[model samples]
Target: VNPVDRWDGTPLADAVRAGHRQVVEMLSAAGAELKLDVSQTSVKLCDKAREGSVEGVRLLLDGSADVNAADYDGRTCLHLASATGNLMMTRELLKAKANVNSVDRWGGTPLADAVREGHSSVAKALLEHEARLEFDEVKTSSELCECARQGDINGLTMLLTAGADPNACDYDKRTCLHLAASVGNVAVVKRLLEHKAIVGAKDRWGGTPLADAVREGHEQVSELLLAAGATLDFSAERDARELCESARLGDIEGVKLLLAGKCAVNATDYDGRTCLHLAAATGNLVMAKELVAHGAGVSITDRWGGTPLSDAVHGGHFEVAMELRKHGAELKYSRLKTAGELCELARVGDTNLIRTMLAVGAEVDASDYDGRTCLMVACATGNMHVVQVLLDAKADPSVKDRWGATALADAVREGHAHVAKMLLAVGASIDLEPSEVVSRLCDYAGAGQLEHLELLLNCKADVDAADYDKRTALHVAASAGHLHIVEHLVSRGCRVDAVDRWGGTALSDAQREGFTHVCKFLEGRRQLVVLKRSSSQEQLNLK
Candidate 1:
């Protein structure tokens, strides 16, 4: 019974595939063990279910085949049965203890697959088993839209009766009517009209169901929607503007309509910008591909003299930008120093985009027009993700901008202490001269940056350097009620007795600022010093 055929089909798998229910029962009685871990065994069960052999599936389950065994792609027999609309096979699998809510490696649950494959009965069965759904309403708008698109009248009625809003819209604001009209489902359209689905609803791009039908060349659907009060809402000038708007918004339907209407493929608006230009600028690769396929000029520049590829790169949309390059779009400059693009991406914390730019031959230390390196931009914006990626790419943290400030300087100046720690760890020098060290020390002390202040002290910065306001680290720390900094500075020999230009001693400032802890610490230190002096004088008298 364990012997395998050339196709690796065991006796049980072969019997199940051949639809021999009695043979499967006999094999189970004879103790022919199932290959639960073997991918081929699971594949055979799925294949039988996929072929709509309900008895074949039942036989396999009765013969001790694992109901939840999944194939290499993580799809169990239940998934296959549900996808193929085999309701009986699904029921048998579920009765055999199959997982109703199992998700595949691609995050597709059986319920999602069932709905997507238009298996309303199987979907209902899975829901009865408590299959997790993306929405808790009677049905998601996507499910309702799918039912209409596929002409499943029963599914549509079930969802609407269960309180799924007929007027429910998707992310692009397309309703069930829009989807039904787009696919030219006449009966579904009639059913949706009976349910009072809005006939004149405009999507995000102001395209109605009639416009959607026309765009898809569904003349019958268009006539039906128009008879039920759908409007055209399209003119020559409106088409040009809508094309640009749709391209920017990544609306594939609206772009297709403008293209079909023979609105010039290269039609330009007041900005002398074509749909390709808008698509590239907004990182809409779908619209970009469509425009290019319709013979939109890739090399054409806008009034600003920027081509589509240049605009894409400038917006840090490197994937779409690369797509443009694949279609022979010229680069405005060398790929070696795409600094402006890198800086923009770093500011937005797009580590993947920065990696893509570097992979395309961008220099790691490339600086923008303002001389700010990508690392500095990342540090200033507190994007630790981008900072880590730049550091891994061996970005030199020591490179200064036009202001002579390093990445570490920007991190410290911008109050990004964690970013400063990363910069310092990577050997970015904060080794300032004595004068600069004093200024920075005061800044750190006042801001309560304990770790950075400790690092500065380790670098031998003066503990008592006063700023232009004559405020030493102690005065600033005490005024800010930074108890830790006040204690650290005092330990490092900052003169607590010395007054600032404002005529305020550290203790006085602490008292005036209501820093009780700082006041107690300063008072304790003064008392200790006085007691030590008194002890010294007593010892001198004894001598």
Candidate 2:
């Protein structure tokens, strides 16, 4: 009842819709008030009222449910009841002091709902309650922002005419005019300008409407703002400074503009760090690539005597380091090293250095001082790219570290399903005895890795593999709500009714964990299995 669903539908609505009168009565007695926000189409009370359930409506009203709670779309219970042509429900709502002229999200009142839904009696009843025939309603600033977002000029006018603030700022301090200009809503922009919306208003991000238009490539919107006294404000020294700042902030838009205006790509900031150096330090591959394309030298050293490639490697941007290498930036860190250095590079995701070491006859399966192999370190650190590189070099995933854990175990333990699947696919031996093999299968099943589970089953791993608590892979899959894995296990001849040590069947486990889809699947499979047994018994009797 407290944690509403994504649509903001409450538990009370669910009870009403399910016709659970007793639960509704209890919840009502607990003081569950009807509250509809912007996303709700209609409330549970309204849904009940629309179905002509007078008792349900009465129960809700007795519980102090507001008769006039409007959804984001502005549809109330009376509107729903009128549209649904539920005369008794409408009368009950009207009698409960429901507002007759409450407008919906679309600004239609209950009388309009009645008229449009072909309920003349409901319309007459609403008119009797002083309901207006015309469509009109006050619009809030939020509604004006929504109109601006949708490029709805007519909606903007209606809201403006109804006294909505032209310069109203939303939660983020973004005015309606800012939103209109961001999406290049020219008509809405002009309308807002006519209503005297502040042209120089800055949002929470310090971005004005003109800056937003320029950033988004809205040339017309930019020109309009410029004609309305917005300045471009690009100076030579400022461009050089902003270039490095954009590279540091990873602001691709600002960098692009500065680049298009022929600004120096290799311009140094006050600290003597060029744009390329900043991009490398920030590990922004796209920004680095853009800087490289604009003639920024990757070999250019910063004030601290670090090249862009050195900065990339030091910042753990192995991908950026690789890109710099592709552009002929000399590798400085690929010199010969002990097993410790290779392990360190692998741990840092320096795939290029690993490749270089391997090419120079360095052992691909070398263990660190702590007895952890490069493969184990990569898998444990959740570095999939480095893991793939080591795997391609034929590094053994079955090698145990100091604690007797293999790369496969590390991948599964770290929730790296892709890495675990790769290990299994590449024939990393699960050569443990029966019980340990079953435990490994349960790990993959628990991780919800359908691909890994299928691979394990193909590798002669038992489909009915169970862990320590007698929890089968089915129990694991059901608890985790992996429907596909559950179906695959059942189709692979795994027992449908296998119970764990807790005396819980897969169905019961799914139910306990609130995995509704898995519960339905397990229940359906169990019923089908029962029906087959019954049919077979019936045939034997006939024989």
Candidate 1 per-residue lDDT, tens place, 423-533, comes to: 878778754555676788888888999877876665456788777777788887888999999989988888877678878888998899998999999999878878888
TM-score of model number 1: 0.42
Instruction: For each of the candidates, give the backbone clash count.
Output: 0, 3
Residue lDDT tens for model 2, 1-543: 445788766777677656688888888778664455423424656767667788877766665566777766677888888888788888888889988888776777777666655566777787788786443222245666777888877656755653457877776778787888878888888898888888888766566787667555566887788788865454444455657777887878767865775667877766667888888888999999988888888787656566787777657677887788788775343222335666888778888777755653457777765567888878767898999888888988778776667777666556666777788888875444567667767877888877666655655677877777888888888888888889999999999898788788889989999999998888899999999999999999999
Note the Cα lDDT for every prediction shown. 0.78, 0.74
Highest TM-score, which number?
A: 1
TM-score to native of every candidate shown: 0.42, 0.37
